[model samples]
Target: MQKNILFLVTGMTPQIITETLYALAVDSENSDKWVPTEIHVLTTAKGKIQIRSRLFNDGIFEQFLKDFHLLNMRFDDSTVHVISHQGKELEDLKTLDDNELAANETCRLIKLFTEDDNSKLHVSIAGGRKTMGFYAGYALSLYGRAQDSMSHVLVSEEFEFASNFYYPTPYEHYVGKYNSQERLNAQHAKVFLANIPFVRLRHALPDTHPLKMDGYQFSDVVEQINQSNQNLSLEIDFTHKYIRVNRGEQVNIPPRELAMLMWFADNKVKGKSGIKAPTGKAKGENSVAENQIIEELTADYLKHYDDLKGSETSIVVNKEFFDSTKSKLKKHLEKKLGVELAARILPKQNGRSMPFYLPIESEYITIKDNFKDRLVSIQ
Candidate 1:
């Protein structure tokens, strides 16, 4: 069964929750109504109290459900999450730290819900502090799938912030001071649900990304996304036999694997196409073209290896060595840089018997100038 989740963030005003629910499931203006199977809320300690008193004690939530004939919906104290920092529930977002905590909590809840493929999340950002709302929307943008949505509920101006109004009631209910009060019909009030559009970046973040982990702060998520968006650059450090990705983290690559990587990088820089894998000559059945390719690749690989080792070595580059080196380099790169990034620098075969070349463009790849000079001098 598909679970539709309605997630909301509220401050002192708990009315927004009911107002949003009314807009989602009861409003005549909403042609495509989405009745939530479950509802979850994120709020401050004070806001939780307000929700308990007005929505539960006052029986307003149950009234709304009964009035609309909604059934099988889940909502209780367990679903109402209070924003906390360092194990302390925030009474209110008084300081910048409190605001950041709220943002983190919002992200944590959104991430948790989005992880469940069976659940469809509908996020409401109409009631909380502006920063909380922004975080809610932004978090959804980061993690939301196709089944997820975000929106703000719009209430009629007179009832927008009215303490007496929760949702437009089904019957003729009037709420105001007895004297000097303007008579208004609850049923006639308008509540419009404005759907928000956001750029979904969930696909951009792989499962291995830090944003997928719990307790990743909002700023950390933003930083990760920013890094992912930036141009990918590969830098090889010949001195250390390691490669740096986007100038971050030194990934130690073996000498032989580094040689293979250098072979591809050198070819990419020289605007040459990829080299084909050597076809093992069983019973001396090697083709002339295969032998030529193996000889050419072996010479290049030996040049890089000798420079890296700072001496001439008797390492033979046959079919087995080439295949093993390529496989190990691919697996190592994938482990260190992740599959998406590894794909860019890894040599990829187009098809059977086709040349394998680095997928990343030449401009983004750089061999250290000093190392290049040394390799050139040795050559």
Candidate 2:
């Protein structure tokens, strides 16, 4: 069964909720109606009070449903979500920290809704503070799938922000003060739902991305998405026995696996073609060229291994050891970095039973023998 969800963000004016609901389900202009199975609103603590008092306590929401004869929509106090930070619901978005909390909460709710494969989310950014609306729309763009949609409710000029107005009623319902006023009828008000077009980046995120997990803030998700677009780079430190990706974090693998990676990186930097794998044979068992290649690679691997261990020991780099080390290194990189990034740096074989070489461009790979600090003299 398809679950149609109506999600919104609001501030002082809770009327946007009723107005949006009217446009979606009651208005005759909306021929293709989307009557939500459930409605959820994200707001501050103060906004929640206004919604409760004006929409529920005053029976405005109930009256609207009765007037339109709509049914089966689940919305109540539980669905009205208040933004919180550090274990307290925010009273308002008055400070920068409060705004950040609202943004993170918006992202969390959107992520939660989009996770349900059976749910089709409809996000309304027609209410709330400007920043709050922005966060809501941006969060939808980040997590929204093909089934999800976004919109802004457009009310007629006279009815918009009118204190006494909520939604247009079916019968003659007069609202507005009677000072200089011949009262306006609520039935004549026009509400247009403006569908918003957004660039979908949900598919761009990896399946195992942290955004898929809970507790990630809005800024963290944005930073990760931004980092994914950066050019691939590797900083290898022999002394530390780790690789720093994009100058960010250190990734450590087993000493033998690390040595094998170093060998491949070195060969790539030295402008070598894919090198053939060793046959693990004695001098006469393999061809002369194969024997020389095996010795060269084994010696290179041992040199790196000795440096990493801080001493040399009896260790043989046979064909089986070579293949296993390569496999382990690939898995480690894939686990640390994502699959796409790991594929770019991992050694690649051109064809079946072919020589393998590092695929990453040489310019991006930097190998340092030792860490050094530079001191600048002031004139």
Name the best candidate (by TM-score).
2
Count steric clashes of candidate 1: 0
Q: Model 2 Cα displacement at 300 (Å)?
A: 4.2
lDDT of 1 by residue, 1-379 (tens): 9999999999999999999999998888789999999999999999999999999999999998999899999988999999887788889998988888888888888999998889999999998889889999999998999889999999887766555788898789876522436766677789989999989978885666566766668876676446556788888766678888888878899888998898888777778788777776523667888777667767878878877776655555667877788889977876666555676678888898898898777888877634555332221
In the order shown, the candidates' Cα RMSDs to the true structure are 4.9, 5.5
Off by over 4 Å in 1: 94-100, 177-183, 203-217, 229-242, 252-259, 262-284, 302-379
Q: Residues 77-167, candidate 2: write the lDDT tens digits.
A: 9999999877788888999888888898899999999998999999999999999999999999889999899999988987775667899
lDDT of each: 0.82, 0.82
Number of clashes in every candidate structure? 0, 0
**Which portions of model 2 show Cα errors greater than 4 Å?**
177-182, 229-233, 254-257, 264-379
Lowest lDDT sum, 10 consecutive residues, model 2, at 370-379
